[model samples]
Target: MLYQSFSGDAEVGTSIFTMNGGSLTAAIGPLFYITNTDSIIELKDADLTAMSGTLLTASADRWGNNGSNGGVVTLKAENETLDGSITCDSISSVTVMLQNSTVLEGSMNAENTAGSMA
Candidate 1:
C-alpha cells in the first residue's frame, strides 16, 4: 500500500507491517514503535521516506511482558531514506537486505545487547 502521510506511533503487537511494492511517507510522528516481543516489520520491495519523525523500536520496559524475545525489523526494500533517526535500543533487531540502499539523515542508535542493525 501507499501511504502519503503517516503520523503517530504504530505499535505493532505480534503483527506485521508489510509494505509490498509500495511506499510509505512519514509526515509527522514516529513511524513505528515496536512494543510486542517477536513482532516483525517487513518492508518488501518497497520505499520509505521519512519527512519528519523517526522509526524506533522499543526498549525492554516497552516490550510487553515478554521483553526477552525482542522484536525484528526487516528491510527488504530496494531503497529507503530516513530524514529522522532509526533507533533500536538494546531490545530489538533490524536486518537490512544487502541489496537495499538506505540513508539516514538524522542518527541511528542500535546499542542494546540484543539490538542489532545489519
Candidate 2:
C-alpha cells in the first residue's frame, strides 16, 4: 500500500492510525502527523519502508497547543523494520519503542525532544 499523506487530529484515548503485519510504502509526504493530545500511531509487527518523509507531531502553529502542554504521540512497534526518516517536534511528547528483532534503516530525527528505541 502507498500513502501520500497521513495527518489528522485524534481525540484523547484514541489512535490516529495503526498498522500491523503488512508492507506499507509512503510517498513524498508525512507518514503520520499527530495534532491532538494523546493521539497515537501504533505500528506493530509490520514491515514499513518509507522513501523520504516524516512522522511529524503537530504543526508549527499547533505546537504545544494541547492544553498548554505537549501532545502525547506514541509509536509502539514490535518485530518491525522501518526505513527512512521520522521526526518529532519540540512541543510534543513522543514515545517510540521498537523491540524484539526490529530494525531501523534510516534516520529518526527528533527536535527538542527525547524518546526510547529499544
Candidate 3:
C-alpha cells in the first residue's frame, strides 16, 4: 500500500514502509518508527493477512476517498490477532494528530510520550 501525508506543514514528514510480511505464524516483535512533525496516516485491509496468517494487521489505505484528508484506518476485529506485545521507543518526542473518525477508545502503553488529541 501507499502512505501519503495530508498535512502541508513544513516540519512534517510521513512514511509508509512494510517492515515485515511473511507469516504471522512465525515469531513476531514490536514495530517501531520515528516522527518529527504532526500528521495523520491510514492502513487498509488488502489481503495483507493472507500470507502472514494475520487476522489483524496494519496496512495503509485511502481515507474517506480523500487521499489528502489524512486519516487512520481502524483495526477493530479481523481473522488473526496480534501475536505479542507492542513497544514504542523514541529519543526526542512525537505528536498525535487525531481526526474525528479515528478513535482510540482503548488502553495503550508507550515510552517517551509527547502530543495527543481528545
Candidate 4:
C-alpha cells in the first residue's frame, strides 16, 4: 500500500505513466490528474481501484489555469482489472483499451472535441 500522486506538471506536452505487476488503490483521487495534451496511462497484469470519485481525469489545470486546457488521454489495460470511472472534460477526450482478460467495472466519459478523439 503505497501512498503517492502522479501529477502532469512536466515540461513535456505528452505525459506517459506505465506500471506492471502490482496493485494500486487510490488513497484519494481521480488517481490520475493530468493536464497534458497527450496523457497515456498503461497498466499490465496489475490492479487499479478507486473507492470514490473517478479513476482517471483529464482536462485543464487543477488550479484556475484554463489556458491550454483540454486534450486527449489514452488508457491501456492489459490482463488487468480496473474498478472505477473515467472523466474527460467537454473540450477533452478519453480513449480506453482493454486486452487479454482485462476487466472494467465502471463507466467512462469522453468529450471529444474537434482537436481530440475518443
Q: Among these predicted structures, which one has the highest TM-score?
A: 4
Residue lDDT tens for model 2, 11-40: 335456777787776676666555434655
Question: What 10-residue stretch in candidate 2 is worst by lDDT?
Answer: 1-10
| Over 4 Å off, model 2 | 1-13, 55-71, 110-118
Q: lDDT by residue for model 3 over 58-118, one digit each (tens)? A: 2223422332233222222223233322222222222333333443332332332312212
Give me candidate 2's TM-score against the actual structure.
0.63
Best candidate (score: lDDT): 4
Report the Cα lDDT for residue 14, model 2.
Answer: 49
**Candidate 1: misplaced stretches above 4 Å?**
1-14, 44-51, 61-63, 66-69, 98-102, 110-114
How close is every model to the real structure, measured as TM-score? 0.55, 0.63, 0.26, 0.75
Model 4 — which ten-residue stretch has the worst lDDT?
A: 1-10
By lDDT, the better pick of 3 and 4 is 4
Query: How do the candidates rank by lDDT, highest first?
Result: 4, 2, 1, 3
| Candidate lDDT values, in order | 0.53, 0.55, 0.29, 0.67
Candidate 4: where is the Cα deviation over 4 Å?
1-10, 62-67, 110-117
Q: What is the lDDT of residue 38 in candidate 4?
A: 70
Tens digits of lDDT, candidate 1, 1-118: 1111113355434455666667677676566655434445656455666555575544444323554645566644345554566666575676654346655556566333446776
Error of 3 at 113 (Å): 6.2
